[model samples]
Target: MAPKFFATRAHLLVCQGQSCQGRGSALLYKALWNHLERQSLAYYKKGGSLRLTESGCLGACSYGPTLCVYRPKPAGGGLEEAWYAAVDFPLATRIAGAAHEETPLPEEHRYGPE
Candidate 1:
């Protein structure tokens, strides 16, 4: 059977591979969940639109504590995807807020599409 999907505005997939975890991605993931809890957007079943998930490697192990965001594009134009690297706690909070508000991700400490 196919897995069911939720209608989430976006999902924050934090890298939890060996490299990212070594760089404290686990803490970053926890921090994001905390922020999501505060905003009441942590669970899709609870009528929330934001989701926090863990991923493996993401093929950018050099950039530990990395994360990716996937959301729908405008005009039903498929999906928009972006991967970010070198994410720390302070920046993680900013990202959480931006994702929750459907705003642009921060420009600093984020280098991707390579």
Candidate 2:
């Protein structure tokens, strides 16, 4: 049997594909890490955890430096996903802050299909 896993309220996936990396995803990722760390949400072992991951292409190469946030459903169902594009350090910091506070993503930054 597969190992059981604990559920987190939020997950943030930053795209590190060639295009995104070229467009400064690394800087965005670093900014995100710093923000989460400051908010005490950097690691699962720490209090107020948030799962952060670096992913492959999210199929939005034209919108390099893309990111996706997964928020768990309140009714014990699957997660709700949101995609953001053209992320920079400041926007990345805001995203991290949103995850820390369990708030919705910034509307202006959202991209991809509905």
Candidate 3:
């Protein structure tokens, strides 16, 4: 059978690889969850659902505690992903707010396209 997938407007992929974990990815992940829950945008829910995933090694070990945000194409094409580096709790909260509000990410936090 084919794999099942859930539709969402945005997806946040937090790197939890060894390097990132050592650099505090776990705390970042927890902060993100708290922010999302406060915003009422839990993963795989109904309306305003934003998918949150823990990713392995995004290949920017030097920039540990990295996160990638993916927004689905409105015109039915491929997804758009952006990378953010050296993220902390505050930045994670802002990222969650951006995804919740359907707004662009803050310039400082974003690294570039991933």
Candidate 4:
């Protein structure tokens, strides 16, 4: 069984695929990290609870910069995953903040006590 996490509200997946990168996903990725650091949110990393991940194409090339957030649903409910398109730095931060309050961390983000 996968180890249990600290019960994060959400995990953010930023598209670093070729198309998204061309549209500025790299900068967006940095912006997301900076935002989390600035807020000192509880990420899976040493500092915060938000998990920032680099993902492949989400199949929204026309939209370019796209991100997907997986939020854990309440008991008896399914995963509440949302896909965002044409995301910029500011929007990513806002979305992440909100989602962080609603979802649980993905299995990939769960790390053992350090």
Best candidate (score: lDDT): 3
Which digits, one per residue and each the tens of the lDDT, describe model 3 over residues 3-34? 77766678899999999999999988987887
Global Cα lDDT for candidate 4: 0.74
Whole-model lDDT, model 1? 0.80
Question: What is the RMSD of candidate 2?
Answer: 2.5
Give each prediction's root-mean-square deviation over alpha carbons.
Answer: 2.5, 2.5, 2.5, 8.7
lDDT of 2 by residue, 10-103 (tens): 8899999999999999878878877777777875446766778999999999887999988876676877788998888777777767776778
Cα TM-score per model: 0.82, 0.83, 0.82, 0.77
TM-score of candidate 4 against the unseen true structure: 0.77
Sorted by lDDT (best first), the order is: 3, 2, 1, 4
Report the lDDT tens digits of candidate 1 across residue range 1-114. 987877778778999999999989998998888877876787554757788889888888888889888777756899767778898878877776676677877777677654
lDDT by candidate, in order shown: 0.80, 0.81, 0.81, 0.74
lDDT of model number 3: 0.81
lDDT of 4 by residue, 1-114 (tens): 988767566778899999999999999998888788878764755645677889999888778698888766778496677777788876787777676555333233222221
lDDT accuracy of residue 13 in candidate 4: 89
The regions of model 2 sitting more than 4 angstroms off are 1-7
In candidate 2, position 4 carries an lDDT of 62
> In model 3, what is the error at residue 73, expressed in angstroms?
3.5
